[model samples]
Target: MQKITPSLWFNNNAEEAISFYTTIFKNSTVTGQAYYGENSPMPAGTLLTATFQLDGQEFIAINAGPQFPFTEAVSFTVYCENQQEVDHYWDKLLEGGGKESQCGWLKDKFGLSWQIVPTIMPKLLTDKDKQKAGRAMQAMMKMVKLDIATLEKAFNGN
Candidate 1:
């Protein structure tokens, strides 16, 4: 078992959420599931918890009812090796009612926030030339989905 798994509370959609997440990420899997017992609030055999892995990180999702909601304060960051990877994640994640947010942040259909960032972003943002870094920052702010080429162009002052 992992040391500490991030648990998501859902209103009876833990199974569905796990399935959706597994499809979006590579090397992902639904590890296990638990059902509510007879004495539980939900009916017996109802899905109560689902343990899953995205890429390699373990997560747990529970069908604990809608007392809580996902907020932008917590989000997962996907670091892409290139523009194509970034686009792939950005497009797939934003499908089915997902909303795009500023600076590469997006909320998926399940309301989980994600940051589709490129691996080059840190390098550009931390460049010794403040002007270049500022330009890159400006370029990123205008985009919903991050574009590596555009960021690079801005970084080079093109």
Candidate 2:
């Protein structure tokens, strides 16, 4: 069991969100779920809570109410090894009505913010050579979905 798990609150759409997420991630799975019972706030059989894993990270979701909506203040970061992996996740997560944001940030259909960042981003952004790192940062700032090749070229002063 993980020491801490992120719990997402949705407006009676936890099940749908779970399904969408599980389908997008190759290594994801629905671990368990609980439904509302008679006398509960919601209709009987309605999904109340669910637990799932995405690439080994466990998360819990609750079909609560619309009182609290997801915000960019809390976003999940997906570290991709290469451009292909970054593209795969960026495309899949933007399915339905997801909105694209600047600099590798986006909001999924459910309003959940996610950062599809390349694994090499940190290394380039923190390179010992300030000029090279600045160039890479500038290149990344202009991108919606990160491109590993562009970043590499910027870092190499190409």
Candidate 3:
């Protein structure tokens, strides 16, 4: 188990989301699943919770009904090594349905927000030249999903 596991609540798509998540990340799998007990209050076959891991971080997705929905306040940021990795995740996660938000943020079909960021973003953005960082930030603002090459170019004042 991870030191801290982030739990996501879904109206009823917990299992489906787990399947999708497990397919995306490496070294990850569904660890546990709990369905409503026979003598429990809920009906049979109703899922209570599903535990899974993504990049070693354990998470539980619960079928907690419509009480809570995903908001952009919390987002998953995937630090990518290169453009290919970024594109791979963006294309796969955004498959079927997803809305692109400014500066590398996107809402998956499940309304989950994700940020596809390059590995060098922090170093580049925090460089000595504020103007270069500003330019990169501006360039990023125009992109739906962040492009690492473009960001690198902007950071280099090119």
Candidate 4:
């Protein structure tokens, strides 16, 4: 078990969100779950909490009613090795009611924020040559789904 697991609160679709995330990320599965009992505030059998793993990262989802909703203040970053990986995650994560945001950020159907970042992004954005780094940053800002080719071209002054 992870020392610190992130818990996401949902209105009442913790199960559905976990299922959707498992399908998008490989090697993911639901680990455990708990339902509200008859004496609880919610109806009996209502999902109270669910534990799941995504690519080895453990997360807890709770059906805590509608008191709280997901916000862009916090987001999960998906480090992709290349353009193919980036595209795959971007497409899969944006399915259903997901919406694209600037600079490789997006909100999934559950309103969870995700950053599909390319692995090369840091190297390109932090190059010693400020001009190259600036160009890469510019290219990235103009993109919704980050393109490694474009970033590389900008970095190379092409």
lDDT of each: 0.92, 0.94, 0.86, 0.94
The residue pairs found clashing in candidate 1 are none
Clashes of 2: 0
- Residue 65 of model 1, lDDT score: 85
Per-residue lDDT tens digits for candidate 4, residues 22-124, read: 9999999999999999889888999999999999999999998889899999899999998899999999999998999989999999999999999999999
Q: Model 3, 107: alpha-carbon shift in Å?
A: 0.8
Error of 3 at 30 (Å): 0.6
| Steric clashes per prediction | 0, 0, 0, 0
lDDT of 3 by residue, 3-118 (tens): 77788999887888888888988888988889987877567788899888888888889987788899998889999999999898888888779887878888888999999998
RMSD of 2: 0.7
Q: Which stretches of candidate 2 lie over 4 Å from their true place?
A: none
What tens-digit string does per-residue lDDT give for candidate 1 at 1-158?
A: 88999999887777877888889899999888889998999999999888899999999898998889899889999999999899899998988889999899999888999999999999999999999999999999999899999999999999
Pick by lDDT: 1 or 3, better one: 1
